[model samples]
Target: MNNLLTGLKNILGVGLKPGSYLNILYLLLAFPLGIFYFVYLITGFSIGLGLLYIFIGLPFLLLTMFSWRLFARFEGLQARWLLKENVEHDSPARWSEASGFWNWITSRLSSKYTWKGLVYLLLKAPLGVVSFIVTITLASVSGVLIIAPFIYKFVDYELPWGAISTMPQALSLTAFGLVLGLLSLHIFNGLAAVFRWLSRNLLNSGQRLAVAE
Candidate 1:
């Protein structure tokens, strides 16, 4: 697992920072809010503005912002971490003396890189949606083959291709099923590889953002 993650950092165009493993690091922060977002959507909690703001609206927006900054910092950090470079990040030593919420927020705002990183994080959801749909589609076709015999009962007998009105025989179906099941693994692995590459590029903006910084 460490080697795979490390390879991701060092791979061409990935350019993750050594200590910045920020992408993996900050994923935890966004997790709980994600759960809440799903629940809120399911419950249809849009009637009350105040409640919606606190529960549904606010968490979603904040998570979006949080995900963005966190991942950007991750990308930047991963780059530094992998390359073993000590890029200068804004020093926060003096902020320990001053004690105010507004002051801390101001200090964070001063570093524009964080905001830049945040923008990158916001893009993650859309890329994720595409990745999910493609992967799920390929995997679902494979799953249908795996359970071909059982599928006859569950799936309505209308052929989408309009090729056959009646269901296929169990023996032939099983043969095709076996072939599909085996081939599906190869296809899934290939699709996963493509998606993982896309994710590294889309989510880990370490190389480009680092140069921009």
Candidate 2:
């Protein structure tokens, strides 16, 4: 019985940990950032490629590549801070000191890492949406169920699925909520792991390129 109680305590405590909260925050931020990245890349690439025949498209495409590189670096930093993972990326060489705009563009275009960064940015939107939806839905449902007993008593109402008038019923709902909340935290942690993996592999120039080669 003591072992059972300890296990229960551990399960309940998982949701309240600081790291779990950070994972939640990271997932929440991913949604908006993903939408922005998807829109920006889609628009930029579409316009740039559409006008590739003209003289102007080359510069636009180069600019888009540079933008993706910067965004990848930012994502690496975010993962390091929020996911508490070490994401090492290769620093871009100082091409401006050596030559002009064309030189910098040529370097970016030639690098496989630049292309991988673009791929990561392109994938972020769908992954972000999935993670955000799952996290928010699970967290919200768990939260509501956890407090349903108190709310039912104070507001003189029962939940749609069942009544919470009796103490046992209320306790059951609370217990279920506790378990569900822990499950939600686990889900968040899992998604955080995936994002961290992506950041470490796709966003990092040095590691990804080396592995590919």
- Computed on alpha carbons, the lDDT of every model, listed in order, comes to 0.44, 0.81
Q: Which tens-of-lDDT digit does each residue in 100-161 have in candidate 1?
A: 75454444455555554444344444444554554456456656655656666666534455
* Residue-by-residue lDDT tens digits, candidate 2, 1-213: 999999988777886689888989999999999999999888888889999998788777777877988888888889989998887766655776638766555556666678777888888899999989998899888987788677757644356885668767877877889889888898889899999888878877652233221
Which segments of model 2 are wrong by more than 4 Å?
1-13, 153-161, 207-213
Question: What local lDDT does model 1 show for residue 135?
Answer: 48
- Against the true structure, candidate 2 reaches a TM-score of 0.84
Alpha-carbon error at 64 in model 2, in Å? 1.0
Q: Report how far residue 3 has shifted in candidate 2, in Å.
A: 13
Q: What lDDT is reached at residue 5 by model 2?
A: 98
Instruction: List runs of model 1 lying over 4 Å from the truth.
Output: 1-94, 97-107, 110-113, 151-168, 171-213
Colliding pairs, model 2: none
Scored by lDDT, model 1 comes in at 0.44
Candidate 2, residue 145: CA error in Å? 0.8
Q: How accurate is candidate 2 locally (lDDT)?
A: 0.81
Candidate 1: 10-residue stretch with minimal lDDT: 204-213
RMSD, candidate 2, Å: 3.9
